[model samples]
Target: MIPPATPSPSAPKPSRQRQIGGLEFILLMGLLQALQALAVDSMLPALGTMAVDLGARDPNQRQLVVGIFLICSGLGCLLPGTLADRYGRRPVLITCLTSYILCSTACALVTNFDQLLVLRAILGVACAGLMVLPAAIIRDRHEGDAMARLQSTVGIVFMVVPMIAPSVGQAVLLVASWRWIFGVMALLGSLILFWMATRLPETLRPEFKQPIAPRKLAMTMGAIITTRSAAGYVLGMALIQGAMFGYINSSQQLVAEHFGAGARFPLIFAGMAACMACSNFTNSRIVEKFGARRVSHTALLIYIGTSALQFYIASQPNETLWEFVPMMTVNMCLLGFLGSNFTSIALQPFARSAGAAASAQSFIRMVLASCLGSMVGQAFDGTARPLAFALMVAGLGCLVLVLFSEKGRLFRRLLPPGTPRPIA
Candidate 1:
């Protein structure tokens, strides 16, 4: 009998010396992602004050504060993954965080809206690493259901940031100028940077590293776009994410002025975010047992049903906060399931090129989502109708794309029973 082939000595071990405790790994990944959430959600409470401070004349322009950041981040996301694939995840991430800290400080001191926006654009570029790297890191460590579970677990912590971020911003505005919110953001970025530099191990395999060549990069990206499973899920994610971003952009207006939540806007927003956190917690528990497709596909259907009802409610002439908030909250909860699972599924096909795949998908997804969000946000006319309509359309689009990817099938596991899961 032939002897068993020996494993190559020079092969890179993904878990070699990188095996921090599972809980620590999850927390680090989650906090890295939460930085972006904090950047967006915390600023929600202060958009009005910041606009007045910066001499903004048009109310619609204030959405640009959030909108510009998201768009720039999307554009910036296109490169980090390619560079990370060549250089390494650790160095690239550290640079991004350093930039984030510096940009946050500059934003705190801006004298005018244009200066603030320019700084925010740069800051968004830095923040792109926060969005892309965490997913790539998880991809480096796990795939399929394990990846979905890990993403959901991290999402539990990520969702917590949005839950309390508005409250944090509101509290800051109570004692200081809205600019102090940027100061707080800078401080948090500093702490996260320190934690990352000291504790997180690099996960990129040695063999996966490649030169940053244009032809190679273009080919990798082309492959990603051509892969039906990946392309479909990426498009679906962008559509759903567009709806979520729309809600984020218009949420303050809908909850505070239109629904008359006013000073209680932070509390109402936190309550809705709390439901999403709960959804992530629940997804973490059940994703592995039922599979990512089954959980997310079912959630997507429920989301569509919920969104249609929300549109109906919003169209009523005398709609109340009670009627609106619950449906919106449910839709947000469903999002917790969709975001991580769709990401995992789209990424399943790319093992060596995970970083590039993540980069391309994030760039496309965020740019498209931000544009759709800007449109939906601008359509706000002192009511929730536009946001609701956008969400319903998003859900339908997502379902269609998913159907195309699955070849008219849904909720079927690709893996058979008794297959052993690889340890991360």
Candidate 2:
């Protein structure tokens, strides 16, 4: 295993690590972040209504409501982890949740496109706190198989929410306006706030808590980029994330144009989401047996393979919805299997600098993913052609990055012959 980066002379770790049910905590945390995701995807189907109702003249403007929010969320991923580290996870989470709730309510109340965009950005920033805090808290408590279990458990909640959130958003549109989506979001955020107030406790210990000083933050950021394994995993994640961005951007067009799924599109999208949820649960069960390194490596290979076949199909003239859906499901399942393991491995070597490390890693990955993914997603030529191109190229490209960053060592770290695995 890769060793943690060197800590400072006066560096400290939790003297008496707090004991808690990691699965429960991480799962709730995942739900909080998933709510942020729901904000983006849930409103996708309602983009036109939002645009027309608000009288946004620009065709590109409706997408900006969701697109800009996503970009902000990516930008927002930078700080919460470090903030949670300096302060306590619970307090930081509470503050973030409160801000998120307020901003989401503002989104619902907005009468203009500009106000909505601005509020969405604020909501994005607050939601950033939701995204980073949970991972940092979970990592503080577990490592290896235990960490994977916690991640998988959390991922199950995360994956499942995306499947249902859009449907709920669609249902809300049936009776109320798109603004009600924000109202529902505010309610959900409040529920999370309540949950944190009661069920959650500070995971960062006194010794582990440092003042949020400039030098410490700089040092923490430096170590992550300097560390070999940490850097590799983060880059690998960014590459995969870019593909995800492309998929999110293109799904609507592809489903409507090629599949002719029309208004029932979210149902099919939800089905693909279901594939991801199942894959995450399976990953949780087997990651202990294979180790994060092995599972990520193998999954990447399969993703690349699936993308290649997709590329071949996209080149053909007679491609149908059947071609896209099945292939995309396989692609998404790989996403579920890899997401938690890559994060666990990347953050593993930075335990001492968990807060700063988590902040920098999450921020960079989000920036990389949003920028690259957005570009690729927008490249769609009103067809599945661009989507397939991005998927295949990004999948293979990410695998190569993993190989390069890790110096070609992957899957070798799986359990030794006949070795047993542990479960949390």
Candidate 3:
């Protein structure tokens, strides 16, 4: 069993301050992460309209808006955590939020496709800190199954934004131009920033603040990559998420254009997303009882099974909307069970370097997922086969990674004696 490293002995420990309440902490972290989701999901319904307005000659090119944001966000993830480790989480997060707000408003004012894509890239980079720092903060207080439960709870809240985001985009299109979608994004970002500034306290422990020397950074990266469980889960989760990203990139195309769900796209999208939110809620309730390894390992197998079914159906000539939707929804449901638990397990051995660890893992995951997602998105053939096949392949790859991480072991809970217990 991999054990988390203890706090550095050389660094001086600081006195703890009053931390935020449990419920509010979960809510704030969820919303901060949700900002990243809101930006992407909310843009889906408007992709077609924006494509035309921005003079995108090819429909697939419109997807670049999403793909570029995601890839740049991955690239952006490389720095913030290391900086946060040296400086502090709160100040770095504030700077990121400010930049995100500014870039979002700029995106609203873009007059051409090129201009909009450039702004989207910047927006994504700014938002990477939102994704990286929250995990670090959560790790500051919890570890192992307890951390997994908190993550699942935060995920339940985060899933709410995705459930309604496409509809939010659709609503904006009905009343005003698509640009107003970015306006809404900026407004929401502002509110979250305010809440964070006023309520959230610094969670990074004093002893963890080591100097940002090249040798130290290299050692940290080396530790993360060489650690068996950490590397395996990080790569495994990325493969599966890459499959999900493929779906996100193609959902508007496959559902609206291919399946004849044009007008009802938002409703259909919301329905699938609701499945995820429900799964997250269930995970938060049961993860502590069943254990992160047991639940996630079981879910990973089920995900592979569901993906295989989806692929088989997609290969058939007479596939219908009803047939495809059910299998896809099952896969989405399994994701909520897999994501937080995989993350917790991967980061379990890095308590002292949570920021650097989270940052490195997130960078690898996001870059790989975005590139793989873009490939899947570009592979759309006016059919669901590409997506179905990608999902199946992703699941198999994840299984292989997990096997390597555990040295062929599965479903074994390896908690050390004094790991933090689940928060009430």
**Which model, 1 or 3, shows the larger lDDT?**
3
302-360 per-residue lDDT for model 3 (tens digits): 99999998999999996888898889999999998999899889989998977567667
Leading candidate by lDDT: 3
Q: Per-residue lDDT for 273-390 in model 1, tens only? A: 8988888778877988999999999999999999999999899898999999899999999998998789889989997877566677777888889888888888888888999999
- Prediction 2 TM-score vs. true: 0.83
* Every model: Cα RMSD to truth: 6.1, 6.4, 5.8
TM-score per model over all chains: 0.86, 0.83, 0.86
- The models' CA-based lDDT, in order, is 0.85, 0.76, 0.86
Model 2 lDDT tens row, 153-180: 6766777777887788789988998889
lDDT of 1 at 170: 92
